[model samples]
Target: MTQAAIQVRDLCFQWPTGASVLQFCSLDVPKGEFWMLLGTNGSGKSTLLRLLAGLLQPQSGEIKISGQVGFVFQNPDHQLVMPTVGADVAFGLVEEKLSLAQIQARVHEALTAVNLQLLQRRPIYALSGGQKQRIAIAGAIARQCEILLLDEPTALLDPDTQLDLVAQVRNLVKSRGLTALWVTHRFDELNYCDGAFLLEQGRVVDRGAPEHLKQRLMQ
Candidate 1:
């Protein structure tokens, strides 16, 4: 069996208001696998992603994740801090104390992975919404993260852009052998996923191949 990239057991989380968000028996993401987290509004999709990203502490249970984790938010604007694509991609690496040449090399490799190398010096404001999201992915790649957590990353894009971004992200993740947990409510998006976990009120109700889950929903 493939080694697990992310593992959770008896995981539980509650909001400050004493409302529970996640109460799961167990969850696991095997290395190099892609799983879609499907849930409706108020179903804790984003909450789960946040917990996986270590943004919030769980009230109880355990979360074991391997390697570095990178988060790509629903809004690319939230991740882009610098003026240009190259600057934004390298923003997180500034504190790593690496030489300028090393940083440049990492930045180039990441942008090239996302097919954005030519736009490295382009202004962030000049890029389209889809391009902005790709830049966010590039930033994560530059960080050399082994796992990626995406919380409805395509929610704000147009239909065409959404499809394009999803396809690009799927390809990047597969090619890099990175594990990803993508949260989305759009059923059609599952076409680009390998497997899926369905959530309701923070509980995993079902999980299987994306096509299988879609058939179950239809029935």
Candidate 2:
């Protein structure tokens, strides 16, 4: 639809030990829309995101992604490399060949967008789980990413904080016109997505209204 921001067509991937991870799986995430992928453990959900992010190579099929891509992991500790929040966020821009002033502006804008400007100078270890997620997302924004891929970003947060992080991501998608595809198993999180895809056995068996998928999974 409207030239998807993230397009996966007939993707196929397998491990070196002859274990199939994904097979003929395909999906399209329209530009500026927020979508979620739901699947049980070992359904290849995280593997698919990694493929789209170019972290893994596919055995077959094609993946077309428009604009810069930003990836957020389930654990912030896996990606945040800098000691301070601002440094971590700014770390993403190291290869951009930007001047100090330009990098500072980007860091400020990104932190402000995530409502983390006040904690920009705080040590990374001093932040809470939710704040850590915000910092990770801010790092993506600092790079001016147009497409965001998140792998169960709320997995470590409390119930309320989980919802808060999802809501915050939804706001970022709408406000910044960024396309986001998030991987999640939590049914309640479906309420925030424009659509949802149900993956089973490494393939998409259901895709449509989030509520419909949520209800089907419940029943």
Candidate 3:
């Protein structure tokens, strides 16, 4: 078996308000693979992503991640905090205590990788939704995370922007060998995923290659 980049075993979670979400959920994501998580609203897709990111603790389970992880929340506003684009991209490196020159070099490289070099000095508020999303991605890349998790990354974009973002993510995964777990309701988007898991009422009901799951769901 391939070594898993992420492993979850018998996971369970419930909100503070007594709302139960996941139960007995277990999954493993192999390194360098792109997996799409499909489910309807309130179906624990976002919750599962949070668990993978280490932002939320499972009530009763174990989650093991082999390397650093980057998470892009459903709301860009939640992830983009710095006032300027450059600062935001550099935020992750602040803890490293790198020299100013080194930070600037890494910031420039990360921005250019996402095709956001021209907007380096721009204010965050002036950016379009797609641009903001790319900036968020750039910030994640700057952190040098081996795994990227996104929750509804293209939810609010126009069709063109949506396609562009999807292509960008796919390229990131292929070129950088980054493991990705993307959660979205659009079943069509699974065409880009190597494998997929179907979530129903917080549990993984079925899982397989995208085409197989599609056929099964349709039948």
Best by TM-score: 2
What's model 2's overall lDDT? 0.94
C-alpha lDDT of candidate 1 relative to the true structure: 0.88
- Model 2: lowest-lDDT 10 consecutive positions: 1-10
Candidate 2 per-residue lDDT, tens place, 70-122, comes to 99999999989999999999899999999999999999999999999999899
Deviation from native of the Cα of residue 46 in model 2, angstroms: 0.7
Best by lDDT: 2
Candidate 1 lowest-lDDT run of ten: 21-30
Instruction: Report, for every candidate in turn, its global Cα lDDT versus the true structure.
Output: 0.88, 0.94, 0.87
The model with the greater TM-score, 1 or 3, is 1
lDDT of 1 by residue, 87-109 (tens): 99999797788999999999999
Order of the predicted models by lDDT, top scorer first: 2, 1, 3
Residue 101 accuracy (lDDT) in model 3 = 97
TM-score of each: 0.97, 0.98, 0.95
Per-residue lDDT tens digits for candidate 3, residues 124-173, read 99998889999988888888888999999999888788878877888888
